[model samples]
Target chain A: MTAAALSLSKIVAGHDGHVSISDVTLAVPAGARVAVIGANGAGKSTLLKTIAGELPPLGGQMRRCATCARMGYLPQSATVDTRFPVSVYEFVAMGVWNHVGLFRRLGPAVRQRIDAALDRTGLAALARRPIGALSGGQLQRARFARLMLQDAALLLLDEPFAGVDRPTREALMALIDGWHAEGRTCLVVLHDLDLVRQRFEWCLSVDDGHAQLTPTAELLALRPTADGAAAARHAFLRDALRA
Target chain B: MSWLLDPFDFAFMRGALAACVALSLGAAPVGVFMLLRRMSLMGDAISHAILPGAALGYLAAGLSLGAMTLGGVAAGVLVALAAGLVARRSALREDASLAAFYLISLAIGVLLVSLKSRNIDLLHVLFGSVLSLDRDALLLIAGIATASLFGLAALYRPLVIECADPDYLRQAGGPGALVHLGFLLLAVLNLVAGFHALGTLMAVGIMVLPAASARLLCERLDSMLALAVGNALAGSIGGLLLSYHLDVPAGPAVVLSLGLIYVVVLAFTALRPRPILTSEVTA
Candidate 1:
């Protein structure tokens, strides 16, 4: 078997000793476009954060191939404070800090890469504006621009399409498709099951603090039937009407 | 020209002006970071916390600059660390813990002052004698300003990244904790330096007010920094002149001048008509 891009065995992850996901064992093949799906508060984000090394696993063994050394993570948009006085260009330039480190000058080549990333993400013209002033979609695009500059072998996205419009979502999905074509490993946390089935080959279903990894078709088959889904929709509408 | 040149005619006046300029240059930039981080009151708390240390130094070695600065830095760092610990370990929020610690520190400082020092010395500690600054005080202010400028330059990128998104910085392998502690140390250093000219009670006034005023006028970070420093310098010069002519206290005069600038800026912006839709086409 080809070496797995990422492998986690019996992992327990969360913050401050409160484990959100427990006993998660899975291995993702290299170049797989995997979708992580679950209801709200199901620890999907916690799993992604652990894989990205943002949160340490309480108990687990995680191994990554040498080719997957460079990993990029895009946290949910709500986690960033847009009120800070950073320009789009300056914020995107931070993606290069891992390579350049502190005190290294942004030479011509680095500047070119930053500019190219901004241009590709459609943020070149708004480069000088403060991030606080940008709309939500624009800010998400700027974040994508920063991710483009990362140029990682593995990418982890948490709610990447949350609160985004259709065109912007399509544009972002196209970028991910390009990354997939280049054989980069991607694990995306998403809510739309249809989109996941359409785009991803594998699915990791997280529910009740456990994760089940399966092919997308198999996972879709395990989802609730049409009558159950309709009942869930009706219950949701009733709650909304009562509110 | 005479109005400008007259303040420098006397050695004492020149020394006072130099002290003000040095304090402004060093403390204002740190103040900008404090404002951006929404820790403006933390500066106030640390300034108060310095008082007990200064009092201890006075008790040990009377009116010694090195001793008092050392004492103040130690006390400030202790309070910061303790408050941070309490906030992290307990249910109390950081600001609430800071308030509690600083109040206790202030009471202790006052008790220490009453126990050992005379009223004349207490007055000096409460309100600095800017016009009577000796060469030692002048050197201390200049040295701190120079060091702080270099320190800020070195920590600028990490500090900004940490403020923007600390988790992202950590994921990118930047030293977030080191940058945070270094920034706190710099803040304490600048506050100690300001105490020589503005005194512990009023030192934070000089640091925060000028930065606050500049925020209303400038939109970019670099511009805001430059404007804050400029506003501080202007307030210092204007306050010194006012104290000379009107015979008011110099420290409050300087801080009040900054406050006046803020009010004026507020009024000016309020009167100006705002644009309805300022968004422009990008590309």
Candidate 2:
């Protein structure tokens, strides 16, 4: 049996005293590409935030196995203040904070790594450009570059492909595939059913106040894509209005 | 040359110049961070919050620099923490809570000052006596400036990450809250130091105006920091000279100099050609 990278026992999560997802118990297997799916306001982010340790879970316990000690979290693009005065290279170089931290110079090896990450993300030419000047797709690519440089064991991505161009999305997906090949665990919050269906083996469905972890193939097969897509769209509109 | 050199001839003028220059060194960078965090107005609120502490210190120790500085730092930090707590726990947003607290702080501070001290002493606390800088005030300002620079250096990486993407910092187990609290403490320290020369009303002026001006012209953080500090240094010297020659109050003159620089920067950026708006392009 594969070792569990992350384990959550009857976890209850929320923000600012309001509970969003309750009794979410799951043991995410090492190397599993888990897709987190839900309607708007269904606490998808709340769950991810809890696992990433950004928000403290209101109840229950979470344990990260020894191998998955380091975690990388990519928040939604809009949540980042891209308008802050920083170059793309400088922003991406921050990923080495784990190693270089404060006071240590970004030595040659780390500089090379940052350069390689930026190059892979196709941001080499725009390295010196202010982050604020990047288009949505470019900024998303910059974020991915930073995440790559983070060299984390577990990656939690929130809507990573949202507002990104198809080509950029494909490139970023390739990066994730590379990490998956290296046996890194990824919990991705995604809205694209096709991508989730094609790429992910497991799904953590976050519905109104509840969370269920299931096999993606089984879940999609039981409902099929068309009906599931319609229901999701309906729920999105309903939740939008309620919010 | 003599007109410029004349202000430095007096020991008090020399001391005041040293104080202003040192205050700008620390305050400008703090201002740049504050502006980037979108907490520019929050500085104003915090400066007002320092008032009651300074007042209480004056009431207790009667114009002792150490007492006022200690009291100001304590009061400033308490209000900051209280406001943060209220914002986190209550429905009101951070800015709203800070606004509410600062208004109350300002009123209490004025009331406290009027209780024991006469109006003349109150004026000294409110406007500051920059022209009469003594040894202890000079040492305090210099010490704060040196400490602030080192603090900012130590906190640079976490601070930048916190400002740009706070969630990522928290997720990575970086000390985001501690960095924020530390930054606020640095800001308060700089404000307290500045109040010795510019008064509470104008202390934040040194912090914000040059930073706001720099933001218009600079596209990089390092450049912004350099430019803001440069603007502040110019403002300090120019304002001191203006006060000496024009016979105006030095504190307001210095702040007004920084403000003038801001207006000039605003005008320069406004007149410069901007990228053509997408809406203006005809297909």
Give the best candidate by DockQ. 2
Interface RMSD values, listed in order for every candidate: 4.0, 4.5
Cα distance off (Å), candidate 2, residue B146: 0.6
Off by over 4 Å in 1: A218-243, B275-283
Chain A TM-score compared with the true chain A, each model in order: 0.87, 0.91
Q: Could you give candidate 1's per-residue lDDT for residues B22-124 as a string of tens digits? A: 9889999989988888878888889999999989998899889888989999998888788889999999999999899889988998888889878877777
User: Worst lDDT window (10 residues) for model 1 chain B?
Assistant: B274-283
User: Across residues B149-209, which tens digit of lDDT does each residue of candidate 2 receive?
Assistant: 9999999989998898777677667888899999999999998988888888888999999
User: Which regions of candidate 2 fall more than 4 Å away from where they truly are?
Assistant: A14-23, A207-243, B275-283
Candidate-wise lDDT, in order:
0.84, 0.87
